[model samples]
Target: MAHSQTEEESDKMGQFDWFGSIGATPEAVRVLNDQPILFTILLIVLVAIILQCVLLWYIHYATLKPEQKVKKEKKKPAKK
Candidate 1:
């Protein structure tokens, strides 16, 4: 069976550009494509760092110590 020129061109066009068009730079895309393992590890590390920061903030603010709670209550003026 023989394929038409347009069909062949269309097939070629359908191939994904490893370097995406507008958002990601070609160099960044190439690095990600080339080193998927490194990318995954880095992504995981970034997420863990973000989660750690959020967890620390939550621990500090969401669950106040008894002494800190007393200080906050003392700071607020009582309504007449």
Candidate 2:
């Protein structure tokens, strides 16, 4: 006689499908192998740094400069 499906098998399938007929192909392993994690992280960090530097420069240049201060001349009153 055939046995009914076990709860463990159903639970495992619910969590992760080892034999699911329909699912997206796993890409993490291939992506990791194709591009080294360290290099990818470093590249992202470098891009962030460059973008930050460019942003800082853009903000620094975009700010309005202080207006030229006008000096007023004071006239001395004639002494009696």
Among the numbered candidates, top lDDT falls to: 1
Which candidate tops TM-score? 1
User: For residues 37-73, could you state the per-residue lDDT of candidate 2 as single tens digits?
Assistant: 7557978999999999999988876684755334577
Each candidate structure's count of clashing pairs: 0, 0
lDDT of 1 by residue, 29-80 (tens): 6566666686679889999999999999998887997767655435677799
Candidate 2, clashing residue pairs?
A: none
> Would you give me the overall lDDT of model 1?
0.68
| Window of ten residues with lowest summed lDDT in model 2 | 12-21
**What TM-score goes with each of the models?**
0.46, 0.38
- The total of clashing pairs for model 1 equals 0
CA error at residue 54 for candidate 2, angstroms: 0.2
Assess the local accuracy of residue 52 in candidate 1 as a C-alpha lDDT between 0 and 100: 100
What candidate 2 gets wrong by more than 4 Å, as runs, is 1-35, 66-80
